[model samples]
Target: MGKKSGKQNKLIPESHFRLTHPSVSPASPIVDTHTHLASTFELYRHKYPAGDYTTVFDFVRGLYVPAGVQDIVDVWCEAPVRPLWREFADSAVTEEGRRDLWGGMGYWFVMGVHPHQASEYTDAVEADILEAMAHPRCVGWGEMGLDYHYDNSPRPVQQEVFARQLRCAVRLGKPLTIHTREAEEDTERILKAEVPKDHKIHIHCFTDSPAFAQRLLDWFPNLYIGITGVITYSTNTDTSTTVRNMFAVPASSPPPRLRIVLETDAPYMVPAPIYADPAFVAPDAKGKKLPICHSGMVPWTAGFVADLLPRGEGEGEGAEGWDAARVMTVARENARAVYGV
Candidate 1:
C-alpha cells in the first residue's frame, strides 16, 4: 500500500504463532497442515533450542518419523523463507543419501509473505510470490494476515497486503493460509468482505476466542482450524478456552463443523512432552529444550488433541487410543479436503 517495509521473521531469524486446544497417536497418520522448514541457528539457539540436526531434511527424518508424523506442509511465511523451503525439498531429492522427509510422511508447502513483514512487501516480491503460486509443490498462499500484537508492520499496510494476497490466491487457483493474532475483529471482517467463505482457507495456528472460532467456522464452511503445541501448556488461557468450549464441549452451540487440522509450526514450538517434559529438558536447562518443533511432533499434538475431544464418539469407547486415532483421522481428512494433495 505504502513504501515497502522490512523485518525478518525472528523464527526464520531467517522467517514464522498459537492454537486454541490441541493431538496424534501412532494409530492414525496425520497431516501437519502448517509448519516451517526455513531455519537459522545462531539467533534463537540460546533462548529456544529447536535442535542441532544436520539439515532441515535430517531434522525431519530424525525427529518427525519417530514422533509418528506422516505428512507435513512446510510453510514459508516470506519471500526469503519461500525459496529456502523449496531448496530443502530439492536437496533431499538430489543429494546422495539424503534423508527422506518421513517415509509415508510426504512433504508439501505453502508460500507467502507474513503480516509481520507486511511493510516489506514490494511489487517484485509480490510477483515472485505469485510465480511461486504455480509451482506444483506450492499448494496455497499464506502464513499472511494481521498481527496487531506486534504491529511490526503498520495496520494499514498489513490490511492492504493481506487483501492483495487474497486476490492473488484466487487468481492462482489456490487456497490461502492465514495468521491472525490479537486482531480478531479486523481479521473476521476482512475475510468476510474479501475472501469467499467457501474458498479453501486455513487459519493456521488458530488461537482466538470461542466465539471467534465459532464465527469463523460459521462464516467459512470450508475453513479449518490449525491446532498446535501451545495448547499442551496451561498458560495459554485464550487457546485453551477456545478449544474446550468451542469445539470440545460445544455447550453453547455445536462445535464448528469445519474440522480441525494439526501442525507443528516447527522450529518454534514443539509438542507437549517434548515441550514440557523434564526428560527432554536438561536438568541445567536455561530454556525449553526443543522449542524448535518438527513434523515428528505432529502425532503427539494430534494425540493430545484427540484426548481433549468429547470421548465416545468414535468406536471402541474407553479403548486406549481409539478416540485419539479418530481425532487424527479427522485432521488428516480435513487437510486433504483443503489441500487436495
Candidate 2:
C-alpha cells in the first residue's frame, strides 16, 4: 500500500489499485503475455513526477510484483531497438540476477519491427534483432504485422516487411507474435502463405471481427488470441463479441476449449472496473482516473472476461464455469505452451 490520503476511500499512486479478485494471489499468479515494460516505466515516472521509483525494475517490483504477476513478455518492436532491452534481458539470465533485478518475477521478450516502423526497417535493424534472438530471454520474433489503421508505413512496405520478418522467424523456428489492425485480408493472406499452419503464434491484443478471429483459429491450431483490458471497454464491441462467440456453446455441450491469453498492453487499456472500485478514489483534480495501466490490473480484465463466459448445466459444482482464477491459470499455461517462458 502507498501513503494514504486524508480521505477514507481515496488511494494514492504509490498504493496502486487494490487487488480485489479473490483468485488473483501469489499462489495463483498470472502472466502478462504482451506489454511494453520500458515504456510503462517511463509513463509511471511521468505520472508520479515526485515518486521514488528509480528504475524500470524498481517500478515493476513495486507495482506489478505485488499484483501477483509471475511473468511478463515485454515487446521490443521498434526499428531502432531500445538499448535498455539488453539490460532487462541480461538481468533474467540467472536466478540470482532475476531475484536481485526483477524481484524473482520472470521477464521474457519478443523482438520485431512494428508495422508503424516498417518504413525504417533496414539491414542494420534486422542485424540488431537477429543478435537479440540469441539472447536467453528472447522467446519469440514478432509483433511484426500490417497495420492499415494508421497506415504509418506505406502499404507495400508494410506487406514486404511483414513477409520478410515472417520468413526469418519461420526459418529460425521461433514462435511468432503478430500485430494486425484493419489489414485483415492482407494479414490472413500473408500469414497463410508465409507461416506454417503448425507454427506457434500469439495474436497480441486481438480486437478484430469475430469472423476474422474464427478463421485464424480454424487455420492455426497452436494460435491463441490475446485478451487485454480493451475487452472491457464498451466501445470495443469486437473483443467482447470475439470472446462471447468462443463461449457460445450449447448448454448440453461441455465448456468450450478456450484458446485465449491475457495481457495488459500497458501503459494503455486500463480496465473499466478499476474506476468503479471504491478504493479508486484518487482521481486527478480534473476528475481523470488512473492514467496508466500495468500488469497488476490484469485481474480486472480477467473478471470482465469471466462475465462473458456462459454457465451451462455442468458448470457450477461438478464443473466450474469460467472464473477469474481459472482464467489466470489457463492463460498462464497457454503462455508457457506458446512462449515456453
Considering every candidate listed, which one attains the maximal lDDT?
2
49 Cα displacement, candidate 1 (Å): 12
Clashes per candidate (backbone, < 3 Å): 17, 1
Residue 195's C-alpha lDDT in candidate 1? 84
TM-score of each: 0.78, 0.91
Best by TM-score: 2
Please write out the lDDT profile of model 2 over residues 1-341, one tens digit for every residue.
Answer: 34443442332555554354567876558799999998888987876666778888788777778778899999999889888889989989999988988898999999999999999999999999999999999999988998989999999999999999999999999999999999999999999999999999999899889899989988998999999999988889998888777766678865566688899999999898777766665443224467678888888888888788765434532146777887788788889989997
- Candidate 2 lowest-lDDT run of ten: 2-11
RMSD, every candidate, angstroms: 8.2, 4.3
**Taking the tens digit of each residue's C-alpha lDDT, what string does model 1 give over 9-59?**
122221111112234455476667887656522223443355355454555
Candidate 2 Cα errors over 4 Å, as ranges:
1-12, 17-20, 249-255, 282-287, 312-319
